[model samples]
Structures are given as C-alpha cells and as structure tokens.
Target: MKKRLLALCATFFVAFSVPAFAQGTVISIEPGDGVQEALQEALILAEPGSVIELAAGRYDFTGPLSLDIANITVRGAGMNETVLSFTNQTTGSEGLLITAGGARIESLAVEDTPGDGIKAKGVDTVTFKDVRVEWTRGPHAENGAYGLYPVESKNVLIDGCVVKGASDAGIYVGQSQQIIVRNSRAELNVAGIEIENSYFADVYDNVATHNTGGILVFDLPNLPQMGGHSVKVFRNTVVANDTPNFAPPGNVVATVPMGTGIMIMANREVEVFENDLSDNASTNILLVAYPRDYNDPTYNPLPRAVYVHDNKHGRAGFAPDKAVKDIIAPITGLPVPQVVWDGAVDGFWSAFFGPDAEDAIYIREPMGTTFANLQMVKDMILPWGASPDFDIDDYDGSVPSREPVSLPQDQ
Candidate 1:
C-alpha cells in the first residue's frame, strides 16, 4: 500500500484555488455575537462551500453543533486566536461534529466536552489542521471518550493537533482506511493514540505519553469486517504514563507488558522502530501473544506476526524475582515456554523467538517466565529499567485507586 502523505505538500495549493460555493456568505461568530446564534445562522445560510470564521473568545454552545452540510469550512482566527470553550455543555455532546465530504476544521480549540472533542464521520477528504481537542474536566473513564474520533471514513488527515486529558483515548481512529495522523501530541488520556481495524494507515512523528498505554495498533473481533493490517508505527516518543490501573476489577488481565509503552496486537507485517519508549511502569517494549481465553471479557487477545526492533530501555526501580523453575508441556503438542525475551542482542534479529522448543536453553516446559537484560533472566530475569515488582503481587504507584483501566480502542 502506498504510504499516506504525512506532511502538507505544495500540491494542496493547486486544489485550494478551486472555485468555492456560497460566494456571498461570510458568517462571523465573535465574542459580541452569541456563538449559538452564529452557528444557527451558519446552518441556515451554509451551502456546499461556505466559510464560517470565528473570532477569539470562550464561546459556549447551549447544545451540540451538528453539521450535516457537505463541503463546508468552519475555521477560527488562529489556534490560539479563537477558543470555543465547551465547559458548560452538560449534555453528552461533541464539541464539533461533521457529517459531510470535503469538510475542513482549522485553528480552533474544543474542550471540556461530555463526549468526543471533535467527531468526523463518513466524511471523505476531511482535514483538521492545527486544532486542539482536550477534556480538562479531569480523567474519568465515563467523561473522556476521544479527543478526536474519525470513524468509518476514508481519506482522513489529522495533523498538527493536541489531544489530552481524555478519559478514554486522546485520538482514536476506527474502521477507517487511507488515514494519516502526524505531528500530534497524545498525552494524559486512557490510551494515547489508537488505530484499530484500519488498513494502510501511517502514524508517524507523534508524541504519545502519560497514559496507560502509549500507541496501539490492533484488530478487534466480531466486527462487521476484519481489518487492521499492514500498519506502521514509527518515530514517536512514548514515555512514563502508567498511572494506577483503571481497568475495573475482574475486567482486566495483568500482563508484564501490562501498561506497555507500545503494543502491536493482532496485526500482520507491522514495523515498530526508531522510537524512544521508556520510564513506563510496565515493559518498555512488548511483543505479546493474543490472549486465548482470559478473565476479562472486555478485551480480546489477537496478537500475531510482529516485528519489534530498535528501541532503548531506561532505569529500573527494583529487582524482580528470578528463579530457574520447572515447566509443563501442553496437551495440544505445544511447548510450554512460548514467548521469549532476549535482551542480550538487537531486537530485530534476536534468536529468542516464541513457541519453538529447539530454541530452548536450559529449563524445559517452564510455565511462563519473563527474561530481560536483568541478571535475573538467567537466575530470576527482569528486563533492564523494569522494576522487579512489576506484574508481581506487590505494586505501587503515584495514584493507586484508579480503576476500570481500558486500553484505547483502535476500532
């Protein structure tokens, strides 16, 4: 698949001059004019290609602003110039929603929304430029849905944006193809950025931090279609974002890479390289096996065929338990020690592949063990920079009572 364009190219200049529709309409929403009135008027007068300009201030809408029009432009003075504050939107409403083709939103701020900050659905040729989507009301699982959500769409571009404080995810793309999300910041949300059930998508040069999991590429089961294939996650900074486990009791499974910085699950032929992921409470880099059957019904395990390479690990807090224990063989003729972690060499071509018994070293049929650069891998292995207490019975953190931690749903 051809890679989606990451940067705004000069080619757009050619397309920008195409004659616009609704030639006589110049709708302006300013501090003096009520935002609701401007929006109502824009809806009344807006044609296929109308431009509604907004001036700077905190403009609160009484309810959701649903744009069913096609090929319209809703722009603000500048990113910082005009602010549409939705702190008072008490209904479960989105700050801005577009349900059209060739729609564009630029230089605006949408925040404190009861639902997703900006939702664009079924829109082809949509572009969000220099926009900010945030949920500053505080991180509650019920509050933040998504900073920016593009679902079941095609030819979407989300660039130069900021998404934060989302209870669920900063930016979420689901059931979409030919998408591009670049030069964005996703932090302090449930899952920073998630791309699920998407094909031929490119997520590059983005910062994902201070969330439960940083970046996720996965395919969900039982969807109308099976997608999430051939994606690339590269050139991003994923850092210490593991707060307390928020996944509700009996709903989450504790894995070593539990609060992993980046997880590539159930996707085929994916490349993860050249990113700095560290200081997370769990494993810095993880290649997981799809959970077959687990205690949590909320998440389905589906990881397979991943290529993890070229990343750095950081400092450790404590020593994990390491003992050369016994193993048990499976009845289905599968070796017990399936997933292998080899930190002695580079991650790309390392010999410690999973589920093959010929690669076994000493202990045969071990139940499940974690090996890292820690001296314990041979004794009681822990990866470099990971605390021994990780995934163990004893775990503590900056905040402990956060519950119902759900990973960012990519689809």
Candidate 2:
C-alpha cells in the first residue's frame, strides 16, 4: 500500500500543477483505503517548503496529525469539500497539531475532534486562511475547546475562517505577538473570538454571534506572558450572543454571563470602537477587573488606559442572564445598560488618590447610550449601598488614544 501510494503521489506530481512561484515539491493525497497511513506518511516524509495538497473528499483519521517541517503549506480543495473527520479519533489531543514555523494551513475543514480542532503552538509566522472547524453536535460541554487556536507564537494571521460549536472559544489567539484576526465568523461557541494574554493584536472585520460571549480581550493571571496590552478591536459585528455557557465547570469562561457582546477584562492599552453591537441581552460591552483572587504579585488585575468610542448599540441588556440577571439587574433595574464598567481599582490607595489620567476608562458614544459604573470597590469598602454611577459624560475623553497596531504579516 505504501509503495502504491508513493507511486500515485509521483503520478499526481506529473499530472497536477502548482503555482509558478512554488519552490517545493507538491505531494498530493486522496481519500481511499489506508488513507490515514498515506496522509500521515506524506506529512512525515515531506521536506521543507513542500506543498501537501489534499483532494476533495472526506478523510477519516483515528489519531492526530502533526506537521513539524518548516515552511510547509497544506492546501485542500475547499473548506467544505475536503473534510477531515476525527470523530473516531482514539489517541492524541488535537486533530492537527502544528509546531513548525512558516506553516500555512488553508482551505479545509476539521470536524468533531475530542480536543482542539487545529492548534499551532510555539510557531513563528503561521497563517490559517479560509478554514473551518466545527462540532457537528453543536454547543455542548463535551465539544472541543478551541476551533482555530494559536498559542505562544509570533507573527500570526488568521483570515477568512469560520468556527462553530467550540466549548471554550471558536478562534482563540493567546500569548502571541504581532497578530491579526480578520474576516472571520464564529458562532455557537463559548467565546466567538478571544485574544488573551497577547500583545499588539488587531481584531477587526469579524462577525461574532450566537455564543456565550461575542468577543473577549482578556489578560489572565499566572501565565508565560502577563500584562496583555496594545490591542485594537474594531469594525466587528457582535450581536445576539445569547448562547448559554457550555464550558466545563471551573473554567474561567464559564463565569461569562450569557448575552455578553464584547467583554474586556484586566487588559491595558486596549481600544474598542466602530463595532455594530445589538440584541446582546446581557450587555453590549463590559469592562471589568479580574474577579478572582490571585497570588501573583506581578499581575495587574485592573483594566487601564482603555478607550471605547463611536460604537452602534441597540436593544441590549433587555434579557440579562446568569450574574447579570442575578446580581447586577436588581441594582441597575431592567434593561441593565448598554455598557457596564465594574469600577474596581488596585487598592485603597489608588482609589483615594484617584486613577492616573492614563489609566482611566474613556467613552465617546452617540446620544441616548446608557452606561453604568458599578462602584464595586467603593461598595466593598464603604457602608453605603452600591452607588452605581449612571452618567456617561464623566468618562468623556479621559484617556489618550492608542496607536494602531501594525503587523509584519500585513506588510
């Protein structure tokens, strides 16, 4: 079977054609008996800068596939045409695990993985274009964690992708620098798109809906990277994110209230603007400090230097859920607000001295936009009941604008 597959690949090299600028060999693989062995062998034997082309068909695998050769391009016929089904996978965590630099995986779909659908870890210059990862069973706690996940990598570009039914996040980029996630759609996930503990990322031109949370920019504690900063999220359509949180218990995202459009937690120097947000029943946008107690002295739990401006909002917070419905709704009344900021600072000293000019929340929205500053810190210390500030004018032009993030991949 191996010899026959190799001969078939050679025949394909002669019969098929690649681009004129392709500097490497093209090894083609089609679905048939022993296809899992054929594809895995091709991936192992392929040299650097090779193009492993997969034909249009369903490829069944009982285990995971890994690509470790640098500068390899894995091209499929189309996202819907070439399906890699790991429904019966018995070993390995991810359907496809990529650890090589300069690897591009495009035009394919991975379905029904026990773990992550596709994961790129510790790679430099990786790109995922026109790919889709999904669970056929839809939203459930047993679904995979992430659809297209890139972690601890630099110079990442994820464009024209679709992800659904991820228990955690559909498109997640974490602990990476110089990243861009654009022209994507995510639905039926815990978080549609999440940029966590990353630096210099621009997430724009994406559609996020039907998830527990639409888009999240979070800086969590105790990681290889801390203090995530310099992110710009703009021009995204975030609406109707009313899916109940299906993450496993005790996960951080499990705390996310349903119907959250965009939530920013413990991130600095972030900007949110020009987004179309509507019908997100919890709130259109939430800016909050990290709610858990942490022992990391280096972690800054407050979100600072954040600016939100000129975002269209409609009919949000009308049907709040989870914490938003239980705790916040009683205080703020029905239709909680379009934007809610947990007024939490570092400590008593920072609260008494007032936040620095650069570490304030800035808001510039259209008229009739509702907002609230739930003075959580003040309520914790003082004896008075929650003094929720419902004014938006106090936060006008409070922080300096951030420069746009430019990536090497964009150039």
Candidate 3:
C-alpha cells in the first residue's frame, strides 16, 4: 500500500502540469523550543507530494494543526517517542485536522485535546496507520468527544491504531463510504468503535473493551446522510465494556448502556459473525430501534435483514442498567439472552405482513446461547398480556455479503 500511494503521487505530477511539487524533497522539522511556530511554518510552506517528518521528541501546542496540501505524508519517529500534546489548545476544536486528499499520517501520538484528537473531513484516500490518540487524564466528561473522527470522507482506511479515553466514541466513522477500520484497539470510551450512517464498510480484527459499549452500528435521523446499510463486522474481541456514560446530554451515544458488548440499532443488511463477546454485564448483543421520534421520511427506524452467526458468547447478559433494567429485564429476566431484540417495528403492518417482510434480525449462534424478542410493539395493541410471537424461526435468513472496500490507487 505504501508503494501504491507513492506511485500514485509520482504519477500525478507526470500526468498533470504541477512542477513546483518536486520529487526527492523532504521537509524535516525538529522543533526543540519553538514547537508551534515550527509546525505552523512547515504546514504553510509544505508543497504537494512532499513528506513532513518530525523527529523524536515531545511537543506542546495551543491550537490545532491542519494540512491542506495534497499527497502529503506526515510521519514521526515512533508513536511513543514522538508525542504531541494539546493540553492548552485554544483555537480549533481538533488537535490535528486534515482537509486534503491523499494524506497519510502515521506513527505518532496525540494526547489530551479539548475536542477531537484527529479530525479529517471531506477528504479522499486518507490513511492513518500506527497512530495513537489518547486523553491522558482518563475518561472524564471534559475529555475529547472522539479520538479519531473521519466524517463525510471517501476511501478511508484506519489500521493498526490505538485510541482511548474519549467521552463519546474512541474511533468514529460517520457519513462515509468505502471505509475499512481493522487491527485497532479502543478502550475507556463511551463507545469503543462506532460506524454510523455509513455504507460499504468492513470492521474486523479489532479489540474493544473497558468502555460503555464495545462496538456500535447506529443509524439515526436528521443528518446529511440517512439510511446507512451494508456493513460487515466480524472477527473481533469485544469484552468487559462497563464504563460509565459520561457524555454530555443530547449526544446520541450518551444513551448507550454500560457493559454492552455490541449494539446494532436502526440499520439494515449488517452481518456480524465470528466475534468473541464475553464478560459484558449488560448484554452480549442487542438489536433495537432508533429509540426516538423522528420525522425523516427516508430514515427507517426498524432494523432489517441483519444476520448474526457463529459467535462465541460467554458470561454476558447478567447485570442490567438504565433502560435495560426498567423495560427489558422485567420482560426477559436477568442474564438476558445471549441476543436480545427489542422487537420494535413499523406498527400494525409488521404483524400483518410478519414472516414475508424479511424485515428481521437473524441469529445462528451455537447451542446454549439464549435468544429473546421482547415484542415491544405489542404494548400498544390490545390483548397484550399473552406474549407476541418471539419465534427465532420467523427471523431466520442469510444476508448477502458486502463487497470489500478498496481505495482508489490514483486518489
């Protein structure tokens, strides 16, 4: 991938008429005392197709640093050796912001920011490898909302990274396309990893623990984008995400229950398989509605065509909290099934066209893994004393696999 990125930049100059962006030129910044000034100067003077390398050291800054030049690579000696702390950041809401295409940021650490650690918006072919974004004060309400936030971007790849101590989500990808987030670790956040309102995503080979919710795939209303679908989440270790929800009020993630292994809400065609989810106090896997009133005509609040299969579940669904305790536990009892569905749907039509609608959450887990469909919609209907049909067989089918995301080589 490195060679491919390099070759793409090399071919860009030859294909175009830009010559000032010379090849074989590297800009090195070793700021000993004047860290902010050196970085600001480097960012302003950097040309396209150039590499901005920072030497191994600790640097403190008071504002955000952003790059707008295309085909730029910002690298450091190592994640631990080269640290950038934004404890006193006062200007921008993000520690490092990128608005350029074909940008590669690698091997660095960003700590203690007021807002987001690294926020890249509306960029294409942006990659973050071996990067660490953390809040050293540890999970406080004043901590950054997100460690790594990429929104409205295309061909995004985040690999081999560690993010922690976020008030909202450790790693959040929102309203993006063709995304891949793998081989990463997220801990001590409201949500470990959240893929929201996105399409064509593959999230796998990641570790999510010690947070409010291990992983979340949510689709909410009132966004630039709506009706996100076709995401694959598999082959991950999610356990012991029992952190308190410290997010500020009105944020979507603030409602996430502590000790949730994984929650899938208001999305379609999401396949979750081959994950090890255990030791979560609340629930192993949860499928529910959007849990709000919305008027968006395009936003579908029901989760449809979801396939959950072949996962290893251990010691989950014991201790409940918040809504799970007040509404779900009394219906399903403690140690709530291995998989719990809120049984929320789109009114009377759901039952009238029940098995044929294919609007279902499918599960094929191993034996001894309990399952429950809470039949939440029946509360408004008459004769609700008897349980509505919670048959697992009614919601059984296979969803097609989504195509793997592949970034454009030419950017």
User: lDDT of all predictions, in order shown?
Assistant: 0.57, 0.89, 0.83
What lDDT tens digits, residue by residue, belong to model 2 across residues 1-411?
667766756643422354521667888888776778888877788878788889999999999999899888898999999999999999989999999988888899999999999999999989898999999999999999999999999999999999999999999999999889999999999999999999999999999999999999999999989999999999999999989999997888999999999999999999999999999999999999988989999999889988999999998999998888987888789898999988888777655444677788888888989999887787788776557889999888845556666655456
**Displacement of the residue 352 alpha carbon in candidate 2, Å:** 5.3
In model 3, what lDDT does residue 271 have? 89
Q: Which ten residues in a row have the lowest lDDT in candidate 2?
A: 12-21
Quote the lDDT for 119 in model 3.
Answer: 91
How many clashes show up per model? Answer: 17, 0, 0
Candidate 1 C-alpha error for residue 91, in Å: 3.2
Clashing pairs in 3: none
Off by over 4 Å in 2: 2-4, 10-21, 349-354, 398-403
Q: Global lDDT for candidate 2?
A: 0.89
Per-model TM-score on C-alpha atoms: 0.68, 0.95, 0.91
